[model samples]
Target: MFDPVSTPDVQALVYASFAQLRHCRYLLLRIQDPAAARRWLRQDAVMGLLKARGQLGRETAQDEALAVAFTHTGLLRLGLQEDADFPFPSAFREGMNQPDRARALADANVETWRWGDLPGEQRQDVHLLLAHFRRTPFDEQGPLSAPALQAGGLELVQSVPTCPAFIERNEDTKESRLFEPFGFRDGLTQPVLHSTAERSRRLQQRREIDREMADDSVVADGEFVLGLPNEYGDLSYAPDDARWPSAGASANAPPHFGSHGSYLVVRHIRQHVDRFEAFDAAHPPPREGAPSLTEQMVGRRKDGAPLVQQPMPPADLDGFRFRVNDAEGFQCPLGSHIRRANPRDTLGSDVRSGVANAKLHRLIRRGRVYAGECQQADHGACGHADGRRGCGKGLFFIALNADLDRQFEFVQQRWIAHPQFADLDNESDPLLGGRGEAAFSVQSPTAGTRTTGLPAFTELVGGGYFFLPGLAALRFLAETEPAPGPPAQ
Candidate 1:
């Protein structure tokens, strides 16, 4: 029987946490010696450090979180070349994505996309990635955990640079909610998905928000993980060793092929806090003394409560949908960030089509902010001291998905970057949807629909596309001995 309750593998790091992993640590490394690195991964690394998605009670008991992921180039470093058994997806195998291309939505050129732009050690020859998380908000980098420690065991390690991402607790509020540099309580809205029919039924029965999955709220697991049935009830296309004359094995025995793997995208995005505050101050809607001028543009209050339907938001504030109260754009403006990002019942033409489109482009976001100095409340004006080109701190955006183009990139291109959406002319997302000129429209009860003229608040620093291979695939790469002698041809 297919047991959806059992966590697949430590490599599939989709674990649930009670206290929420607040502190995140990232390490980038380059492998100069392949033999030693392979040995380290095969023998020393204990991947159980990160619990899987369906893990039961005791899995998340330990407070820390850790996971390992690698770029397409990283696989080549380990001597795992293109094979018939596992033909990697075209998006990754074709290499880094160029932003100017037709399908590209990210606001970065090929030059800005390189790791070289990163200051200090981040620019080193990066081949492998290790990320860690801790439970407490008041936390520091403890010891080198799991796979990272194993990386140290390798003899030919070139460079290791540490990057930190954390969530600052909203000290102003009695609640334990966390806020980013821009003062938005993130991690509130996320997609709930399931791997099996039984699991889906079980989730529907639970109905409780505290469980692993939700009822109709459950998205298809194939949207994120490989080798799972998607929203359309078909198996997602995955890298597999098939029947045709391929490089590797045929029989499915000890080593599973492409069973629990998923592609990961990491973007080191920078937030211009001072510039954002300055712009918002300069453009305070058309009418003076408007309530939540900035908040209306964001579509949500700083505390993460929605400004539309439930103005006085509930304690746990993310269950409600958009169609019921604000279909006519009377509450939340159509150009606001939330409406543009998700759309829900507020999509183009009609409500039925909007619901369908929303399902096609869902993302599993795992992002955290990286601030420089002013970590708390703003002082009514621009206040950034450590100026790295006036972009102090921002979110280290990360997401996991099966189809990069369909799920993650689609949301960026069609919804965010696109200017003309839902019959609106030349209007982009208020927060993330602008190259430079982002105009925001807000629906107010008194002053009618007010618009705010704003500039870009976020910039893409650098990022890479990586694949989180299954533990079985990891073992296969680790154990494969290098081919000897000269070329056959």
Candidate 2:
């Protein structure tokens, strides 16, 4: 049974990606004045801006929703005292632009990023990220005007620009699904939080089954939220306030700061659609009966079906594993984007251990596309209508995890960016991997392995790591005074 009280503390975004709310805006902000920011945080209007898990399905504004997250700097600016004994992880504390971490993320040119500050670089410091969603397009006077942002003590550090959400509407069923800028289904395979309403809903709707199957989709709650058991059957580590008390220590110490909180990874990944299209057109399918170049790279068809043929139902597209179904990657390329992202049952010493180990590094992705046209009439492709050069469109990538090092970073460094993945050398992930001259090897049973030179398709523009705090922790930051200690430098 769900903990009615504690579960409510989780943010609504943790439960739902708000994909139905097509019109979305992401605001990157910097706190100018601590007192004014604290005052703004305490406001009833500001508090209501953030929604909780229990508040879902009952939201009065069915077309709109809002959520907020904070960087380590943002938390400090909000008067959160630095606790030496128990602190946030190094990745979250140091920020995402750390020179070493940036390299791991394949952000080769982070120095040229419009926003985000590197270590010792104080020019651009983004403290807060406020995201707003709506069904209808935002008018000329968008949700938050310049003056309104100023009034809230938030210096507008340029809106993280995003185009309208891409839609693929089925005329017969009147059902609409999301697509990325590259004209492929987005958010198909996501980690379902264990014992939540979403899991129950999926099971009830027959989207998934509740058996002792090999499906790695359903993961422990602690993988995405703190203070819960993870796939390893251990409670996730959280920042305990009791570890280091204030001068006048009392029995009533504040709750663990990270309890119910999750680490949020945000990346502004710009997709070069024109370049990708040009590349695809240039490289047609190597074999007569093989898939297209785009399909080879993405490891899925345009409608989001896996390349490998599985015996599962259409709703269970993610039910297949690499070792059991396509060990040789004949059906799906070994170095494909989805395979590298989640190499289910193929990375360890054996199939069973590999599947179990992969569970430890799972991430709950909540991303959306921005600024790309789609052709609903054509069931095959849905990209730029004009196919213009330098189309300013990409994905607003967002992922949540309780352990950053093990989940997001590991996938990025060890798999996506690792050129030697799956015993293949000189090739990273075809779609989201490192830029410059790269190669993709597609295994074939009859024909020899066809290797294709791949150009950089995606580039990381701006990104940062943030802490999506629980409602209780949000209130603590808003109302309580900083613990008596020297502020962190």
Candidate No. with top lDDT: 2
Please give the distance, in angstroms, between residue 72's alpha carbon in candidate 2 and its true position after superposition.
0.8
lDDT of 1 by residue, 385-473 (tens): 43322122777777777888887677777777777665566777777755324676654456655354566777776666777776656
- Across residues 1-489, which tens digit of lDDT does each residue of candidate 2 receive? 335355677788888877666567788898887667767777776677678887876753566677889998888877776567778899988778998788777777787776673433433768988888766665544335666668778898867544443654454674557777677777778887786666666666554442333246678888888877788888788765443344356443324777788889988888888788788788787688668878878999877889987756655666677887899989888988999999988878887688788889888888766554434322123334555321238888999999989999999888888878888867878887663237788887877464556677888777889989887778778777666676533
Clashes of each: 2, 1
Query: Worst lDDT window (10 residues) for model 1?
Result: 155-164
Which 10-residue window in model 2 sums to the lowest lDDT? 374-383
In model 1, how large is the Cα lDDT of residue 311? 22
